[model samples]
Target: MAGPTLRTYKAGSIIYFIEDKGSDVFVLQKGRIILISNSLDSASEIKEDVQKGEFFGVKSALGAYPREETAQVLADSVVLVFTPVMFEAFCTKNPRLVLQMLKVFSGQLRKVHRKVREVLGETGQQENSVELLRTAESFYKMNLKDHANYAFKTFLKNYSTSNFATRGQSMLDMISRGQPYPVEMDSLETIIEKIRLGEMDVSQNAESTNFGDMQMNDVGSMEPPPLDDFSQPEDMHIPDMDDTGLSNDDGSGMMDIPDMDLPDMDIPDMDLPDYTPSMKKPPQMNVPQPSASKPALEGITQFYYDGVNEFSKQNWDVAIKRFEAALSINKFENDAEASFLEKSLFELGRTYMRKGDLTNGIGKLSDFVKKYPRNPNLKKAMAYIAEGYEKKGDKQRAMALYNKVVSMPPRDKESNYAKTQLDRLMK
Candidate 1:
């Protein structure tokens, strides 16, 4: 139940990405912000300018769903950030704000309905249910358990009496029990063979498969049902406001607005949830054993070198794919392979940063630091982590890390770099 906090973002900074967990709402107070999304047809980008004094992230945050668009700072801006509870309280005190938000929500819903109709083209409810169920199955096959869970829940919510509902509920139950969806042994063997022959790219498969895009496509295939069908039973109920109008509880006509250019204020730190993949072993699968001609360690080496080559060429996405493939091979291998694994992880983290995915970058780098505390690249990795924090608007934590680097021994290039950044931040 913490209150709203004011935060600032610089131009060229991303506030959040599509499919990020939506935990807080934002109201633009000054400067410019833009919400970026893909068109329903997936043929173009859609950019919506956020007007001053308007809310941008309300729907997803309130519904406890993933963000549907990316919010980017178009100019240096000040924004008031609110948790869902705080937003509800604010709406209760200013019923007019709720009315305004309703107008925006209605427009968005209408657009979504129209788009769904265009895409589905008179599809029956049964077909819609089947499509949604298939989407959930796709996620399950891809080993994206969380996404599969969400899609299954969405399917059950919309089509609980459909023939597929029982299957969807079964999948949900398995996910809750931490069980992986079953894959055919022959398909698993084929994948392994393709991987060994360099005929398939696991990195490409992992990186290119976007859960949000798949979910959206499934949504487009479904007939738009009544709003009540999607509504949660535990939704918050808003009370009717009396005729006294915008008056405060103490009779003040309206709450005062603060200056847009107010000085930097210290807001409590809000750490984002860690998104590191778990190290659990997958369900056992029987497959043909590998030939002695091509050892498993060789595959790891090839993935690592391929990643390095891609990184050298400035192909961030490809490099990330390769490094992730290498890391996925074996984390508990011998010392030589372990070294390659460590380097692959480090490069993967940096590649993510280059691709503007700071969350995963920081997570991977942090994991590297913890697993290999005495690594030769420890100082460099720490400096990169600090830079990621700085870009993410956590200047205080960034400065603290920079200070640590400056105080470390050897006076290396990384320490020098950290010192330079520290001085710039101090200004």
Candidate 2:
């Protein structure tokens, strides 16, 4: 299918600001975009670079809420802009995308609630205060079940006469009974239908709408199941490999991750290849070398190794943190030291991609290729980027990269994986 219209943005351009009304989602085509936000009173700062194959301005576009952060072009950039109508069609065709977006939005809601709680606590106000009741409702919508439970009960008990008491009562009842807080698949289907039929105008939602003013739609307010795992389609009835072609369909290998209360932190089989870094270092080439910091660089090396160990154990969450620490440590000093920085980026990107965080995943992997073009793993790295692009709905680039990998002379495990994915895509 054809994609949305592309727009160009020069470096230093501001796309939108927090609280600005917006109705279009932007897919980064090239270059960089940065999102910046602070607390309601600008007390704390949060910033993220928009990754290739990632969407920006989605929250505002989806809910008709004001933009929650400021988007600016970090470099000469291109973006494919999808209007609500076009975006809806794109999502219907790629159903997994809807689930993916829900995860993103849920995370966003959780962050907002966290900030709200912090502000209230600093003011010496009870969490259940009337002013904070709406924030509690937001907690529920985000599927932060535990937070919602505490917030709703506090609101109901301490502010019974408050305007939000009735709503809190209903939500609290659901939480008490352990009812599913997330909107069901059928409900989502119905919403899509309404939007397609023009019966639902998502933009009708006001720009000033916040947790307090949002009439709770069927938002889920519980800690959702992990994003990386998903059940297969019931009717398709395929072999165990299922959709992504990644999982082992063999009956005996299917092991559920059990809740273990031990210091050892045993991790279950996640169906990924065994983790092993190549002992063979590539011939050094001329690259822009950044000045390195002292003992801190040592810490970065440690964090990178820790990430590798965590990743092998399928402890993705911890692995991600370790990888991030490695990257953040000393702003990821250039390769004058060792391959730790590049290796960390590679693993971090791969981990995020596995966890359905396509943006950061693509960003890190793309950066790795740019920084280490002549590295021995360049071909493998490009293949990873291809998979990420494929996931992001950029078919042309994905197919081209897959074809490139297949054409390369030496065939490795990465190339074989790419070929498998390419065949799947063609089918």
Candidate 3:
């Protein structure tokens, strides 16, 4: 049998499309390719970027089913294409490759089964044990404590006898105790050695004191000598005293000094002055007071109402400006303002669509979908996004969104319109 054929494709090349008939598996040798497909129920578009040394089209080719995706070359690329018989022969010689394919197939199957159950509103199906453990581990690694805690608890509950049960339980306990992942710490011996070295460094850098020829390690330890240890100087004289200690000239026990006369000077007195205060008061001045502040959401409501008025009048540009102004207001202090903000965003997207700006329209609606997931206008916004993508010639994405709308519960006007579009697009 001939080996696989190697082919090169330039950027913007389409290798295949959905529903195409082929039994050839491809392996990306270089550059990039994007596989665009929808979910099992066609409710969401799945874009898989094929990396180097990865296989694509294996399941569909091997199962002899129509191609489930459209493979478009994203860059100048080289690919190896193998027929089903050649691939089987190649896998027979490479058992590891077969094992890898089996793992991939099993994971894909599990995801499909999960999506099916979700679409059928069946909540009783048990989640895969390995996937649950992996999810918990991923969340833990990302430091999402709350999500990790929930995932770990669910895993432990469902897989009590699993090999990873002990690890899951330990992680749960750590999370409960609010302990982060363990970090490597220095040993006791290392810490003690560091302390000892630090003390030695301090001692080496300390200043010493000198007393005569002796050096003291610590200056604070020395004391001063007593004051009575010195004798009187030899040149100093002392007077001898009799029993009464009297001087002969005074005939008294005390010495007498001559009195000195002081001169007197003429002095003049001056008059002092005093004053009394008046009982007049100062004039009062007028000061302006600040006006009362407006409510936090004051301008937002007006802008939203103005935008709605313009939108109803089919003035797309003016409506967009008003909606943008409403969203530009920084303060959304309360739930009422927040609701208005959501409405403003949704209307802005609708205005863009009306103006024939599909890119901006799709962008704003997509933002609304993410930012206001629980908003009452979510389904309507999604339908508008689908309509935008349809107008932009992206039928795959449009169909996917339409399918999602149809799958959502409570068949309202939007869902009904989506179902009609989906049926038309399918036909």
How many clashes in each candidate?
A: 0, 10, 0
Which candidate gets the maximum lDDT versus the true structure? 1
> Which 10 residues in a row give candidate 2 its minimum summed lDDT?
229-238
List the global CA lDDT of all models.
Answer: 0.60, 0.57, 0.59
Kindly report which residue stretches of model 2 are placed more than 4 angstroms away from their true locations once superposed. Answer: 1-294, 330-336
Candidate 3 lDDT by residue in tens digits, 1-427: 9999999999999999999989999999998899999976679999999989998998789889999999999999999999999999999999998998899889988888887878887542533775676578568657899999999999988888664354466556667676553211111122223234441122321211001111122233223211110100000001111111122222221111111111222112110000000000101112111112324355665666566446544567877887788787767666555566776787787677666766777678778777765554566667777766666566877888878777765555457778888998899
Error of 3 at 250 (Å): 99
The deviation in Å at residue 116 for candidate 2 is 67
Better of 2 and 3 by lDDT: 3
Ranking by TM-score: 1, 3, 2
Lowest summed lDDT across 10 adjacent residues in model 1 is found at: 229-238
TM-score of every candidate relative to the true structure: 0.32, 0.31, 0.31
